[model samples]
Target: MKNESDIISLRLLDQTDVVDDFMEWSLDENVSNFFTRGTFLTKKDAKRYITKFIVTHPWFRAICLNGKPIGYICVSPDVGSDRFKGEIGYVLSSKYWGKGIATKAVKMVAATIFVEWPHLVRLEGMVNIDNIRSQRVLEKAGFTREGVLRKYYIFKRKLSDLVMFSLLSTDQLT
Candidate 1:
């Protein structure tokens, strides 16, 4: 495990308590905009989906601060192809925005990957073109913007472009 900081602590989403709160987050508009889902429209659905992810994904976390759940951080394999490598996604309580929580959480996860996983050559992230805050967070986490992917993702019913960013294991800034 990496050193725990005063502002954030990351742990696997293995507890029922974390999954329970994850339901509330799923409904919050600000939190769900970037990660849209009709499957988690109800609390029961949210619980089921989150539980499945916790059980299957190796790097899902309940991002907390001051012992309270504030958000989630995930590093998972990209869908469709291996050429894209892996990517990360996160959602934080709006109250925590502008306080550097997302950036800190991402940096911690990135460092953990470099230190613990020998096969990880690189990790990437995709931020919707309109999400400047997320873009800044990725930059602060030591990822460099690669380019834009046309019609990369669909959110809330419309196709959206995304900015791709990545960090290589050899990048000393980490």
Candidate 2:
């Protein structure tokens, strides 16, 4: 994995990945407000999510700062047309927002994906139109604003339009 900074690392996840802050952020409506999906109903639900699902994804990783998980980053390895293209998503505790944690993590993971998965050429990020902060994160991570996807998702009881951003292996951002 590419280390974004001395304090940040993208580390593999496991079943025992449960953390108190993770559970707390999962239940915080305000914290999850702009997420693409999910607001775990209970602490156990959040824990189960991390253990059973989060740890199983091929491209998922914990966003660690100083050895503590503050968020998660992942690419939907099975969603796109082929293994060469993937959609990415991430979630971080609100306390860490506005600090560039997500931006740095996105860049680090994107770099790793292009290098670690030799066949991969494109990485895409979809941000809810209302989620400007996340859009900025993608922009700062060397992704280009391709176009907007209308009525892209029905997540969390809200149907939303999204902006699509993409990064290609040929682009020189690093």
Candidate 3:
């Protein structure tokens, strides 16, 4: 575990130990709903996703706290239409919610993207309407809500609106 007080260490996702922890965390319903609509209902499903999302995609990373894989965040270039845009998403274990971990992790990722991937002109997220806590995290990390995407997503077997948000590298300015 890397002990950096106040801020959790963010690193590229790899290693069997972190994968084992991620598999367990992925099955938790509370953690699944906020980011991906509870689509990963079992450990096996999560492993398959981790294999493709984490293993194949070199840009994703495990969000670690005290040497434990508590959640994950990923950034990737937007394919087609908007080649200059990038998308980012994150999810944390239910136990870590309300503790500002997500916000911190997001800021770190944003900083990394702005610095390392300078060509990424826009970074965005589509958040479920009912996810107030997540909205707060995005705001705290400097994302501004752009608009409501009505019936943009289906979660838990029902249609739901999504809040679209983005942060530009220039947003750090006044």
Task: Tell me the spans in candidate 2 whose CA falls farther than 4 Å from its real position.
Answer: 1-6, 78-80
Off by over 4 Å in 3: 1-7, 18-20, 37-45
**In model 1, which regions exceed 4 Å deviation?**
1-6, 18-20, 38-41, 78-84
In model 2, the worst 10-residue window by lDDT is 1-10
Across residues 1-174, which tens digit of lDDT does each residue of candidate 1 receive? 123455588876654754556666666677666765443666666667766766688778878887667778988865556434677888887667888889989998888786766666778888989889999999988899999999987888889999999988888675
**Could you give candidate 3's per-residue lDDT for residues 70-156 as a string of tens digits?**
888888788883557888888888888888888888889888787787777899978888898888889989999999999987787
Q: Between candidates 1 and 2, which one is better according to lDDT?
A: 2
Task: List, residue by residue over 13-132, the lDDT tens digit for candidate 2.
Answer: 654556565675576666678865568777678778777887777778888888788788898864546677888899888777888889999999877788887787888898888889
Model 2 accuracy (lDDT, Cα): 0.80
- Best-matching candidate per lDDT: 2
Q: Estimate each model's TM-score.
A: 0.86, 0.88, 0.85
Candidate-wise lDDT, in order:
0.77, 0.80, 0.78
